[model samples]
Target: MSTTTKTNHIGRKISRIRELRGMKQETLAEVMGISQQSISHIENSETLEAEKLGKVAKALGVTKEGIENFSEENVINYFNNFNDNSFSNSQGTFNANNCTFNPLEKLMEVVEENKKLYERLLKAEQEKNIYLEKLLGK
Candidate 1:
């Protein structure tokens, strides 16, 4: 199969969320008023008409766009555009030359070793502050 078809296959897999939510195929079929075989066919097929896709997305509580686009760029653009409001708070006093780590994002994780090492650095900072205060008689 073509790469586009393969991507659509991945979209089909997303339909499994209904089952993972403890919904039987028969249940979805009943709610949809369609046969279980039809639901199975839909979940197994890689391509669908726009109207059919909308029905499935509505039944699955997902946006139709979530299933239709097979392009990576399209997906990325959708997610970035979805968070357009997040970047509207750019009123801070930021000098381009003095700044680091632009393009704000979420923290992935911190390693346990890195955590312990940072604890030591924090202690060193406290000691330095104490020494500076003592020198100034504060």
Candidate 2:
């Protein structure tokens, strides 16, 4: 497939991951440290950069390899099918309660929440530095 096709495939995969995790565009952007507008752009299949790809992979709890290798047709078909399901009373709306796999979404939350731990670590280091400085009369 062409590069355009690959990019579109990745974009649709992102949308699925977001919907699976029940994350809004704004929330995903916050987790990825990018603007929601950027997420919007990427999901719409406009264009994507390596850095944005990394951020999306991190926030979506998917590996770069997985994201890169995802099938465009499957991703797009899923979105199209999902939309169709929403309108079809027989298929109904999206729900994982009936599915077999543990949702990938939890990973997204856990990884993003690690930021809090990082902050705590930084504070502890700062406090340790202060104590050491006082000990040395600096």
Candidate 3:
């Protein structure tokens, strides 16, 4: 049997952290005052300079050490543990009555509001078109 070692690629860590934060290359670039092409280059490199790494960390809203030590497995484990704790009490009891509101009802409310807004806008546009046509006919 052979031993295997994981390679710690700084660029890959940065890319993963950026993705986890729901950030796009363009967004990070804008925050760092760099171009999207530059962000792409940084994400492809295995290593980065100290100053550049600091800037990237700041732009991503994490410490430099945080980015250096980032791991997908750790993130997954963290969220798994968080989810397990979210629905339980201190005595490890699940509470079924903890839900405050119905998600489907909230979604239906938003849809209905959007539909009303769209109908009003459509009616206004139709009235404007009718007025323009009457003027053109004169």
User: Candidate order by TM-score, highest to lowest?
Assistant: 3, 2, 1
> How do all models score by TM-score?
0.42, 0.43, 0.58
Give the TM-score comparing model 2 with the true structure, all chains together. 0.43
Which candidate leads in TM-score? 3
Candidate 1 Cα lDDT to native: 0.67
Considering summed lDDT, which 10 consecutive residues are worst modelled in model 1?
87-96
lDDT of 3 at 128: 100
Model 3 misses residue 115 by how many Å? 37
RMSD of each: 15.6, 14.6, 8.0
Give the distance in Å from residue 21's predicted Cα in candidate 3 to where it truly belongs.
0.9
lDDT digits (tens) for residues 4-57 of candidate 2: 533346687778778877999999989877799988889888446787788788
- How many clashing residue pairs, candidate 1? 0
lDDT of 2: 0.75
lDDT of 3: 0.89
Runs in model 2 with CA error above 4 Å? 1-8, 71-138
